[model samples]
Target: MSTEPVLPRVRPEIAALPPYRQGRAASADGFKLSSNENPFEPLPGVVEAVRDEVALNRYPDATAGQLRAALAVRYGVTADDVLVGAGSVSLIAAFLQAAAGPGDEVVYAWRSFEAYPSLTLVAGATSVQVPNRPDGRHDLPAMAAAVTDRTRCIVLCTPNNPTGPIITRAEFEEFLAAVPADVLVILDEAYAEFVTDPEAVDGLGQRVFASHPNVVVLRTFSKAYGLAALRIGYAIGDARVLDAARATLIPLSVTAQAEHAALASLARDAEVRIRVAELVERRDRLVAGLRDAGWDVPDSQSNFVWLPTTDPAVATAFEDAGLMVRPFPDGVRISVGEATSIAPLIDVAKSTILR
Candidate 1:
């Protein structure tokens, strides 16, 4: 008999899926500009509120009722229309599970969110990745064309992660027109607070809900509210569709601490906007500096900028300059970090630019 150890059977797709890659952490003296995170500390009282309100001995509210009601009021929706989860990624996974199964197909833009592939695979659905345009925006027409009878869901990431370009409101309306009404469409807007472009699509308005019953909007406290550690996010959509997603939700995953922090953050919306405005200004300055230095940077409306280069040396150059940036196969994504980090980042760009 062979002496090889027996292994439990695992689904081939699950076995083959690579783990999600987090942005690289930097050394003590280095600036961590890899993760597109809000550089500011939490809003005043958020930490104190979480500390005071959390009941560690008891389970959290399974529905996150108060948070949902607050979000609904802000967005002019009913409480039933809001669904909370551990993160927007969890909401995506829940909606995918609700709408798709083995042999079904899910559609989204390529080079968008890194988690999309893993989420789809975990839901046992086939992925149809439509390529992004040269400017790093979604090719909505191609994505609409990719829909087939097996297609069950579609994801649209505005100011798409890692690349930082946005889908315009008009373009999104047209894209929605092209997509079948029955196919579920998710608008992932994790960086919505950082967006300064007036033309960028916003899925929070009531008009989108009134017109598109099949559409779902995902928002997170991670990026703007500086609540990444809490891992709380929510979705806005039709009650029936949200009901299906709720059915698929992992019970009580949204902790009481996260909910309290979100409420506290929401209470200080003005402060959040101020912080976001500062980041937007920093991003614009960084982009302008890179362009003036002869780098062909794309129009980034998010909290990060993308440098289109296939050369690994460029990323290494950033590392050498004490800045950690996220590098993809085709380019590198640098988050808008501290005011202090901007000069060094631009200096690196200037030095790395080819004549």
Candidate 2:
């Protein structure tokens, strides 16, 4: 008989993880507002550039030089400060591999981004999550207090996911002051474009390059850029930190077409701005609607709203209305799409909400 073990050996962390699940599309003609994709079509020039790039029959530039250059100009950073990845999500993985290991601790906000604890666990590290405040914002003071010498990094998601809230500049600066100088701080700004917070913190890259030395910012073209399918994202940080990120990344992860499309997007900034402005209006309107309906909705700064439904029946009611929103134990994250896309979700609230 073969001497192989009956069950396959696996890392306990990996084995323990529930697979990643995003809300599914409802039907052939049903709205796909589950994922936070931009409702607009790609800019004319961006589509043409992507088509032109596909004819090259070659791999993308390993360094993604042209895309990096465009991003640098947009962010007011030098080329050395930017590190492009397959997606902003990929950089999170690279950070885990480069910075954390067994017995090390990773910290982040609970219900901020569902991916945080999963990413930390996959890296053979322990996750230390501080709960979000009543308003769905990250609990900055508590998070800063939890950081210890064993802590490798803390991810600060602003205009935080799931719950659309931001970290105020004052709160963030205080959090930074409390954290050890050596501990890495990753500010994931995946939804930065939609944020209307006048007092928001700009995050790690711009300042760390000058002084703090252990901070990084992750941004993506997936949402406001209407490039979700392209899967391109970049990180900005101190040169040394960016170098470390690049070292651990797989070569040529970005496709040539994606690089071209991203570069094309830089030139279409004005149009994207108009579209983003529309989203902000819609988001604010949705928040007010939900709040008036007696659902405790926070002031949303991202492209979504959090319906804090501590009641188990709330999610089922949403589904009963033929709307597929992400239901968390703490709340439901309702993505904002075109007006028509969310009609079903609105219908549910109108019918079931006794008001």
Candidate 3:
């Protein structure tokens, strides 16, 4: 008999799927600009609220009622219209599961959020990705045209990851009018709070939930609120649609600590806005410095800047200089981090351009 052991059956698609690649961690001496994390420390109130949820013996609220109520009030939606998940990523997965299955198709912009493709695949749905425009923004018209009868959903990411360009409000409204009212449209606004561009689409301010029952707006506490470790995010949409997503959620994945932290963060919105403004200024300075050094940096409205280059050598150059940056196949994304990291980042960009 052969010595090799037989393996159990597995879904071929799942087996072939590449694992999600996270930003590389930095060494003690290096600045971690790879992940788009807020550099500021957590607000004191948020920390205290998390600490207060120390009753480990009991399970957390499966529905996350208090947080949902708070978010509903802020958005002017009913509590039933809001759904909280472990993170925005989890909410994305839930939405996918609720709307898609085998033989269904999901459309989204290419070179957008890295997780979009994987989430679609996991739903046993086919992904129809429309390429980004030359400027790294979504070609809304092309995406709108790609939809077919089999298409179940569409994802739009603003201030797109790894390539920082936003979709304008007018463009979004026009695209929405073209898309089928029966299909779901998810606006992934993970970096919404950092946006300063006056014309950029504001999903929350638009009251899309009220106007378009088919649309869902996803927001997270990770980036702007400095709560990545807590893994909390929420969505606002039609109550029936959210109910479908809630049915697919992993029970109690939203922990008490995460919910408390989010509530506390919301309580100090003014303080959070101040911190976001500081980061915005820092991002502008960094972008200006890179442009002055002859690099083609995109206008970043998020807390990160995009360097359009496919060369791995460029990324290695930044890493070697004590700056950990995220490198995609077509570009690199460096987050606005500590004030000290700015000078070194600009230096690396200048050297890379010279090469």
**Which of the predicted structures, 1 or 2, would earn the higher TM-score when compared with the native?**
1
Lowest-lDDT window of 10 residues in candidate 2?
A: 203-212
Scanning candidate 3 in windows of ten residues, the lowest lDDT window is 48-57
lDDT of 2 at 29: 54
* Model 3 agreement with the true structure over 297-319: per-residue lDDT tens digits: 88888889988888999999999
lDDT of 3: 0.92
RMSD each, Å: 1.2, 2.2, 0.9
Question: Arrange candidates by TM-score, highest first: which order?
Answer: 3, 1, 2
TM-scores, all models, native as reference:
0.97, 0.94, 0.98
TM-score quality measure for candidate 1: 0.97
For model 1, the superposed segments whose C-alpha errors exceed 4 Å read 1-5
Predicted candidate 2 versus true structure: per-residue lDDT over 176-219, tens digit per residue: 88999888889899998998778887764335445667889888
The local distance difference test score of model 1 is 0.92
